[model samples]
Target: MQMIKQKVGARVRELRNQKGLSQEKLALAADIDRTYIASVESGKRNISIVNLEKLIIALDTSFAEFFEGM
Candidate 1:
């Protein structure tokens, strides 16, 4: 589960970077807190499905794309 969290975090960071979005920008777009985004990116939080959906939508990605290789 920890590994999954880390992997998910890494993927989020990767996509965020690829999209040229700062954590603050992503958080703003997702309507989430910047610190929460930071924690998620750092794999320090077990993100809920609701919040994950918010992120995925903000990132302009589908769940299939987000979890493509996981």
Candidate 2:
């Protein structure tokens, strides 16, 4: 589970970077807290499904795409 969280976090960070979005910007887009986003990206948050959906939507990606290689 910890490894899964880390992988998800890494994927989020990768997509965020690819989209040229800062953590603050991504948080704003997702309507989530910036610090929360930071924690999530740092693999310190076991993000809920609702919040994960929010992030995925904000990242302009589908779940299939988000978890493509995972």
Candidate 3:
């Protein structure tokens, strides 16, 4: 679970950066808290499936594409 969290976090951060979005921007777009996004990107938060879906949507991506390399 810890490993999965870290991988997801890393992927989120990577996608966020690739999209040129800030934590605050992504949080607002995803309707999530900014601090939560920070924690998530740092691999310190185990994100819920619902919130994960929101983030993926805000990133303009799908789970299949997002987890492609993983």
Per-candidate TM-score against the hidden true structure = 0.96, 0.97, 0.95
Tell me how far the alpha carbon of residue 4 in candidate 1 is from the true structure, in angstroms, after superposition.
1.0
- Model 3 clash pairs? none
- Comparison by lDDT, 1 against 2, better one: 2
For model 1, residues 13-40, the per-residue Cα lDDT tens digits are 9999999999999999999999999999
**Any idea what lDDT model 1 has?**
0.93
Per-candidate Cα RMSD to the true structure, in Å, reads 0.6, 0.6, 0.8
Highest lDDT scorer: 2
Task: Give the per-residue Cα lDDT of candidate 1 at 50.
Answer: 96
| Model 3, CA-based lDDT | 0.94
Ranking of predictions according to lDDT:
2, 3, 1
Per model, state how many residue pairs clash: 0, 0, 0
* Span of ten consecutive residues with least summed lDDT in model 3: 1-10
lDDT of each: 0.93, 0.95, 0.94
Q: What is the lDDT of residue 20 in candidate 3?
A: 100
- Give the runs in model 1 whose Cα sits over 4 Å from its true position: none
